[model samples]
Target: MNKDQVKGVGEQIKGKVNEALGKATHNPGKELKGDLQQAAGKVQKAYGDAKENAKDNVKRNAR
Candidate 1:
């Protein structure tokens, strides 16, 4: 996968860990931060997916 995709997945995993930790520790702020991070990661991953799709489409059309 591309850098963005890899980074996005990493962020998602990190966010999940943070969220679980927050829950276990009863920290609402940390949980919310984790939620936001997860959302950002999802968006980034989607962008990477779109980029890859577009690249493939371009290659297909060129052929």
Candidate 2:
């Protein structure tokens, strides 16, 4: 996987942990922060996926 993909997955995992901790501790701010992090991670992952797909298409068409 690309750097963006790896970082995005890491952020998602971190967000999930933070979200769980926030829920357990009754911290709305932390929970909201986690939710935002997850969303950002998702966007980054999608961008990485698009990049991969484009690269693959280019390589295939080069033949």
Candidate 3:
């Protein structure tokens, strides 16, 4: 796991908490923000996964 992956996962967890809190408090703005944060986190995680995969591929091919 790389930095981006770790951070992405953290962001996702935070977003989930915010979303839940917003819902419990009836705040649409916060809920929307949480949704966006979650989406961004997903994208970041995917980027990290791709980066790791590419690195592995390069190593394998260099052999």
Candidate 4:
């Protein structure tokens, strides 16, 4: 996977943990932040996936 994909996955996992921790601590703000981070990570991962697919297509067409 590309850097963005890897990073995004990592961020998503981290965000999940953060969200869980916030829930355990009864912190709504933290939970919200974590949710936002998770969403951003998902977007980043999607972007990486699209980029990778485009690259593969270009290579295939070149050959």
Candidate 5:
């Protein structure tokens, strides 16, 4: 997988951990931040998927 995809997945997992920790500790701010991070990660992953798809299409056309 590309760096973006890998990084994005990492961020998502990190966010999930943070969110769970925040919930366990009753920290609203941290929970919100984690939720935002997870959302950002999802967006990044989607972008990565789109970019990879476009690249594949280009390569196929080139052939």
Candidate 6:
């Protein structure tokens, strides 16, 4: 996977952890931040997916 994909996945995992921790500790700020981070990660992952797809399409067309 590309860097973006890797980073995005990492962020998502981190966000999940943060969110869970926040919930357990009863911290709305951390929970909200985690939610935002997770969303950003999803976007980043989608962008990476699109990049990979486009690359594959180009290669396929060239072939």
Provide the clashing-pair count of each candidate structure.
0, 0, 0, 0, 0, 0
lDDT rank order: 4, 3, 2, 6, 1, 5
Clashing pairs in 5: none
Tens-digit per-residue lDDT, 1-63, candidate 2: 788898888899989988998999999999998998899899999888988999999999999
lDDT of 3 by residue, 1-63 (tens): 899998889889889988998999999999988898899899999999999999999999999
Alpha-carbon error at 51 in model 3, in Å? 0.4
What TM-score goes with each of the models? 0.95, 0.96, 0.96, 0.95, 0.92, 0.96
**What is the C-alpha lDDT profile of model 6 across 8-40, one tens digit per residue?**
888899899889989999999999889988998
Off by over 4 Å in 3: none
Work out how many backbone clashes candidate 3 has.
0
lDDT for 8 (candidate 2)? 89
Decoy 1 TM-score against native: 0.95
lDDT of 5 by residue, 1-63 (tens): 677887788889888988998999999888888898898888888888888999999999998
Worst 10 residues of 5 by lDDT: 1-10
Per-residue alpha-carbon lDDT of model 4 for 13-32, expressed as tens digits? 98898899899999998898
Q: Residue 49's C-alpha lDDT in candidate 4? A: 97
Positional deviation of residue 44's Cα in model 3 after best superposition, in angstroms = 0.4
Give the runs in model 4 whose Cα sits over 4 Å from its true position: none
- RMSD of candidate 4 to the true fold? 0.6
For residue 49, give model 2's deviation from the true position in Å. 0.4
Candidate-wise lDDT, in order: 0.88, 0.91, 0.91, 0.92, 0.87, 0.90
